[model samples]
Target: MIIEVFRANGALLAAGDDLARPAGLTSARWQVLGVIDGEPRTVAEAARTMGLRRQSVQQTADSLVADGLAAYRDNPRHRRAKLLAATPAGLRALADVERRHAAWADALAARLSPADIAAATAALQHLATALDQEPSA
Candidate 1:
């Protein structure tokens, strides 16, 4: 079951990458944009939210800034860790991907009932929680 879930997640990420491609984004970049949509966050915060390493997030965020998709601002809470906010270009890109994702999700939802999706979501959350509690291998 765990392996199946992992496989499903990989497939989902691949689909997301395809959805984001038209907007010049990969799944990882889209995820970072989604995390900082409304509220700006430091690289560490975004990393924690995305379950990624801070160094990786920082590298991605820097690339996003260079590409004019995102910008870093001074953070009042953190002296060194700057806050990342989406530029207009980033928002536009995110909006485009979201539209595609929504349409794809709607088509799938039409086949699978909402209750089933909710149950699957709950099950995934439970599994994530269990994994979180486990010690590093």
Candidate 2:
């Protein structure tokens, strides 16, 4: 299951890259944009939500800022850890990617039985829960 998950992750990342490329964003950048689309959050917060390292998210946020897709705003609660928000352009780009992603997902899901999909989802969740509860090395 773990090996299959690794393979699936790689395939999904490639698909994400393809979906985001036309909009001038990579999978990582689009992911960051999506995270902040709902509401502004600091880099550490976003990283925790995504289960990624803070530094990686920070680099992606910086790139998004440079591309004008996202901007850093003052966090009233935090003095230095500013919140990241998607710009108008970022939202538009994210909408584009989401449309593409939905279509792709629909097509892929069409090939599988709904029952099978649900079982797979539940199994993965169970595995994730067990892993999360495992004692640290």
lDDT of 1 at 69: 98
lDDT of 1: 0.95
For candidate 2, give the lDDT. Answer: 0.95
In candidate 2, position 96 carries an lDDT of 97
Error of 2 at 68 (Å): 0.6
What is the Cα-based TM-score of model 2? 0.97
Model 1, 13-128: lDDT tens per residue? Answer: 99999999999999999999999999999989999999999999998999999999999999998889899999999999999999999999889889998899999999999998
